[model samples]
Target: MDTTRRQALTLALASAAFPAASASAAPRPTGVEGQRRADLGDGRFLNPVLAGDRPDPNVLKDGRDYYATFSSFQYYPGVPIWHSRDLVNWTPVTAALKTNIGNVWALDIAKHNGRYFIYIPVLVDGDRPLRTYVIHADSMKGPWSEPIDMRIDNMIDPGHAVGEDGKRYLFFNGGNRVRISDDGLSATGKIEHVYGGWPIPQDWIIEGFALEGPKVLRKDGWFYLFSGQGGTAGPPTSHMVVVARSRSIDGPWENCPHNPIVRTARRDEPWWSRGHATAIEGPDGKWWLVYHGYENGFRTLGRQMLLEPIEWTADGWPRALGGDLSRPMPKPRGGSGGAHGLALSGFSPDMFGTKLAFQAPRGNDYLDRVKLAGGVLTLKGQGSGPADASPLVFVAGDRSYEVTVEAEIEGDTAAGLVLFYNEKLFCGLGLGPERLHAYRIGQEERWPPGAPIDARRLHLKLVNDENVVTFFHSRDGRQWTKERSFEVAGYNHNVADGFLSLRPGIYAAGSGSARFANLTYRARGPSA
Candidate 1:
């Protein structure tokens, strides 16, 4: 089909799939309601171009399609690259980095001269030192090259750009930039101060001035630099998006007249600490901004991906158009193709290749902790609970959902599924040799007078709706009984220091191994 005809068909399909008026419906219990674009069955659509816990987003438009990825700190099988044609609905194409590359942070994904590369800045575990690495792929899809240490120490965010002199460069935290070789693999020059980020007025309610996450975009003969400042966490008013631009890549850059393009000025806002952004043009040639923010009262959900439209003023600076981004906006135009989200249903061996991963394992051989064979996931015991076990997990966006798994305990091991946050804060259910363990506030409690069960084969299910979690068990697949229920709204950042979410996961801890099968997960949407 021709380009114009294809664009029209895409628009028609999106309109039918998402209607703008429908997109503005009453907010759902999950708080993500009325955020998705109305598929008007035409190719064009509405807002939140991407969804879920996809924070610190960095997108690269390659040819006719766009590829994006985000911070996958602690989560191995990290940096899953998503592809989108329309920018509204995205599908995971491949997970670029499989090996544990430290605690991954805000990264830059870019393409130059027909080659794709991802510059990752990570926080090393033992030393707590910061380092940046580069990984290359001939095509967006694997096989990708192993990570090459960039040797640019103590950096967190790596923003790639091409200099006016044709030199490759990367701008990192603290407004520093280092030159890279033409191969785009290693650093060649010393890190130098290039741009001084905007300053926040003192006495203003804010987090600290932690100036970081710089993204550079070359547009209309100008080099635009976007950065996040005022700390990422703490006061709801902290963290904000700022912009600067210069005629030269090596600049005397000027800050935006309206320095903060986006920020959370009050606690009443639906989202807080909103910053760390990357700007890109929509398929229709319109501008849009992608960033991350902590959902109000859902800090345990971590920083979620957010989208806002951008309007370029006559003076050349761009401003976020969606206000607080708590409401819906018109969708991007043009382009067709790509799926909206990931589905986790079927179980099979080798499935861990991408869909699931452990959060910051002690070593690379952590995969040895679990055996995936014969459609069952057998995990060895580790630590005492979900906190230490490095439970295998996946990204989930719904406020309420149910997860079920069949497990057969062997040896002296205990195994079950859990909603895990960190070592000090988390809650869920677990099954052991003598009794079913109910976990709340990082401690396990036994209930129902505690009945001992020797059966090796058992099914477990957890139903979590709006932060309240209930557990269930069954000896046979047909008959079911409630095990226990626990309220877990407190399993969040206020109690835990890590800016992590309470994730649904499966874990094994004790001495032996537990075999798991028929794992199923389903989300209860707004109506539920």
Candidate 2:
């Protein structure tokens, strides 16, 4: 096939899957209790099996159960595990890693001989080099062991596989592999470059030839490797899922004839940068691919988990069947179902370790500074504001939602709620007893005509209607005052550096401790 003509045909095939959001006659995306739910309840479902910043999803199928975890960068008690029976509907299980490992990158999860393993890549800068580690557990709901140093060079996104000779291997980003010990505790050798990667067209608008996220799927006497090429967050058509396979773990691999199985061929598509794919055998004995993609026009949500059904070719190759995946598709058969997500109603101490209900950045050491009891969260203040205080944040999946919290300042402490991407890029309203503190993009100032705040207590609420945010404060729970509103569409990875989503959270700053109560979250449909 002529290169240019072949690429055009591929793009055409990709576009055929996408019907504009309004073009489809199928029922539009509906919600359950104001929250987005994928399963339509009529034996059909939508894309984004799990929303929010669930990028680089790694799922391990165990018997009748399915367990998954995503790349949790800087969120402590990292690599959150989710449980699913039907695959479409999921709930939080437990976070695997407790200790803070550098900036967590793409990872993979596998169950081997009754033990579960998660291959983690930590991105380190300065004088140190990038390193990958492994964590193991006797059970999914873990008492997981401390991360063991894999001690390999030039590796990221490690995928586990077993060779014909019965030796265990970890396939890494950029087509590399390393041998693992039988105990699965440590690395046995140096990393070796095996497969180069699929050749990409020079004319295609992509981020780069950044081939990474290698996941191994073994079935019917073949070891199939699914990987992401092109940069993860660049052009709309950049990131993609490509497949290659070998009879033995070590071999000259063959790329799928229909390469780049899943991609966002155009910017107008429903999802963007669709890649980092992991294939699984569905509940109905059908093959399915699970990957991550940025929802079109909403990069602030980060990359979300997308489920696409796949078909196997007669010549023993697989192809993704989900077109641009804008429309609802029939649900998979056989598996059971349940409610989809966790409730961020308040600080649920019971759901503490399992769900990242509230997470701190950089330092997981801040737990010593927090006390949660009876619907109240008290924090010992640090630094001066959200930037240095190391706030406790949670990802808000909905494009529009409302968050309210009541804070009682103790001594000099100031606490309130805000939408934070990182320390540098955040905006919120805080209480300082005598004055109301408003944090704008690059500067903090008083909300002129500063209303006096009680040192003892005040309630703060934020409504993010799309990217525009409005702050309201109340002396009593019912009586509210709208302080100000600002635009926050730029508080995302594209504007900010870290690969992070803008999250809703609270912070405490100053010398004394601050007590927070009535932290409630409600999702509203996107504003007109």
Candidate 3:
């Protein structure tokens, strides 16, 4: 064998054996992994049932299939729809709304009569006017129709309910209701103040009188309305789930004797600021409630989807079964089939339409920024860094995982993978002309001993364990070099306040575009 080839092989083996030699070493835990609450399938499940940054869950059950969507907000490919057979496990089915409608908030997903409809509430620029838009699809996996502006201004969180008169209506925030047209396409009548929300005690430390997230259900001649109050953030005890019910769809609603059905009464609890719930009957005919909450100190994970079994009292009021939601309760029974979540580690050329999505762009300009071929993704550079580039990202549920992608900068531009949280707060490492740039908090710092890259192809990897992130790069895909590491526990809602989580993403920014290839992702446990 040639001496040069033998030396290269020896170096590769040495780097693999020594952690210091390989720059792409996995990150150590930062103590946040213990808070997750999903069935890890290891005879144990984690808390927060749905982890990461999922918030404002709206769930719909179609026959045995259950579909759920949450507030996508600034994230494009708005209205991501998830499917599940058992309420416990969920997987992304499709991103329902592709067109940029506006900054989307809490939405309602329901199947009325025969069609599936999502009532979206968005804030348009001019007056900061809140409008609800309607989109329908024949099937959950949809060729969803374009959004029809309902023109119902100054309202949010549209909950669909069928009245006793066999007519459709929408219950919105601020205790308001509007009658819907027969076809459920548009509004027919004026919005009216319906029921005043329940009041909380004055001495109880809370956020504010934020009457929001009204969800309705018709059960046994009674129409039940579930609403959240006391603002979404502030004190840990703020943001609670409250209920009121009435026999008729219209008036004289009675508040639940136990008005606040679920709340974080104390800060010591594992989850904080719990509210915004949707209730449903489980497959076993048992009652269940799905809601959102910030996990203890890990507010950076955003408000995650939480599942708890509900039991009805003889008097017909509902109660939560999962205590404080910090511990595992009994899993719901009788759910037999369906997958949980899409594994993002592996990708083919066709992965974009399924497992991968770009962060929602303001305009449609970023749509043409990416091209996939032969299992590789080539992304054109945009913005100057992660913030403006609208980095291509995927939601990762694990608390600890590593993602690596092969990248080749075509011009004087730069490209790298990142854990991005909006434009202002993000951190990652990028390669530019003869130097490596380490970014944090919207600012870039240069790293010494950077690799010289005249060639177009380079491999990059990021390992985010808990909130800590580390970056690495490779030239020949064998030997590696660590670029920089950062602790990002504060890149979350409490500090940044976008109601978003720090997400795993890739960015190509600077002068020219970059071609990315062979993206590989892996979830690591304590051992890894």
Candidate 4:
């Protein structure tokens, strides 16, 4: 090989090696696996505090601790709740809901009367409309109860609230509220339309006047209702946070003069379609809003979790203090922990639901396909290929990162790594008995089919630099050969129609089994 080629392969070798003990801490990437971190380690922090498809964030503040979760969609062991002492730093402490109820949507997490409850709104099927369910646990790290059917029909987002009458309530989409029992298990009263949504100007462009995500905060005798207006996605201007306030739960509500508290005004901004926010009091006595937004030009990464500050106006209205959020702002005080990601170097069994998950989980039976033991994952393959299989995916929040894994195929299974977005939309290379199946544009694109493989056991490496992707192979885990390079900037929600990110996935498809060992993931610095 030429000197230039040899040097490039050598550098790749060094970076792909599992991070070893070293004191060269000359400003390495902060988060686990060198992923782009939110905390800058200089007191300030950046947007998307928790990255990679963390949409519809629900944050609950309990004394000095904060527990947060998001919409899990089709992934099993859904609603993975993360624990944080500081809002900026978080780690997945547990997956609250393990049962496959349905396609989970926006939810609300609240602590009521010394017990924790999660109000989940799910869409089962076309014949059965959307319904709400409730699950509770004594602690954030939970043995959560199975979902209790609240019989809340036709609702997509459910927010919990407490009234002055010492009663519990839940607010739903389209300006409606329902009374709940004291135990926080089921709905007690009829759904009542409380207030109409804020009107948008006729000249503005938006997907729809869809009003949803009603999170209530009672402060200083005034209950603030923050809801999202405009559709969740469609236009650059779609989706925003609007607020209303009422002195009592009984009504006489008024809209915040500064309606649409936060929005993406232009297509050039860093974050777009920003909505579904939860207001939380910072540990340091300050106030902040935990929201989600699509990182512009990187929507394939999905709606990332964002943190911004909010201040109460002199006129008693709360206003978002962070500007367009194109740059880093001063972080809120009192959060203390590691950045939000888990390096997949070891599997403690707890890793299944916490950091790694299966997409489009059919049921608890899908769990039968995977076996984790001694840091090696032996996956039994099902389906003809990745499109039919429930691929194992993990959280990847970095703009640039590398995933390396050693695979030994058993039977007819095609085992390999991929950047997966749902079952229908994904791109990656799969290794079968003695051939490579290169996937792109959501399906196998085997035109220049590359060279043939002679063995079933080999080391695979995938580098995602920005949105451009490259795949390589190594026989002895050294001296890698580039298989191909492609651009994946379009592999996102806008292109695929699913609110899913391009997460690194492990797929075992076709026949027998695939044993994955020595898998390592590390976020990369800027292209060198």
Best by lDDT: 4
- Mark the regions of model 1 whose C-alpha exceeds 4 Å error after superposition: 1-47, 126-128, 343-345, 348-354, 446-448, 477-479, 525-528
Tens digits of per-residue lDDT, candidate 3, 224-306, equal 99999998877889999999999988967899999799999999988889899999988889988899988776676688888
Q: Rank the models by lDDT, top first.
A: 4, 2, 3, 1
User: In model 2, what is the error at residue 375, expressed in angstroms?
Assistant: 2.2
> Model 2 misses residue 127 by how many Å?
3.5
Relative to the true structure, candidate 4 reaches a TM of 0.91
Order of quality (TM-score): 4, 2, 3, 1
Model 2, position 38, has a per-residue lDDT of: 74
- lDDT per residue for candidate 4 within 1-528, as digits (tens), equals 011111111111122222331122121222243245567778887776776788899999999899899998888778999888878877778888888888889999999879999999988876667889999999989889999999889987899999988899999999999999999998889999998989998877788999999999999989999999988877878989999999998777899998888998998888889998899999889899999888777777788888989999888998998878877777777667555555433555676778678888776677788886654678898887788778888877767678877777888788888988877777777787778778887688764465766647777889988889898877666668787898888887777775778888778887799877666666665463
Model 1's number of clashes is: 28
Q: What's the count of clashing pairs in each model shown?
A: 28, 0, 7, 2
- State the weakest 10-residue window (summed lDDT) of model 1: 8-17
lDDT of 2 by residue, 1-528 (tens): 011111000000001111221132222121222135677788988877887788899888898899989988877667888889888998887878877767788888888888988889888665546788889988998888888777765578889988889889999888999999998768898888899889999899999998899988888899999999998997789999999999989978999888988888999999999999999988889988989998887888788888999999889999888999988888889999876765344455434445433444445565677786655667889888878777777666667777766677788887887888877888999888788788988458755574564535676889888889999987655668898899988887777867788887788889998877655566665662
**Model 3 steric clash pairs:** 23-482, 36-47, 37-46, 37-47, 38-46, 76-360, 90-340
lDDT at residue 85 of model 2 (Cα atoms): 87
Question: What overall lDDT goes with each candidate model?
Answer: 0.73, 0.77, 0.75, 0.79
Candidate with top TM-score is 4
Please, what is the TM-score per model?
A: 0.87, 0.90, 0.88, 0.91
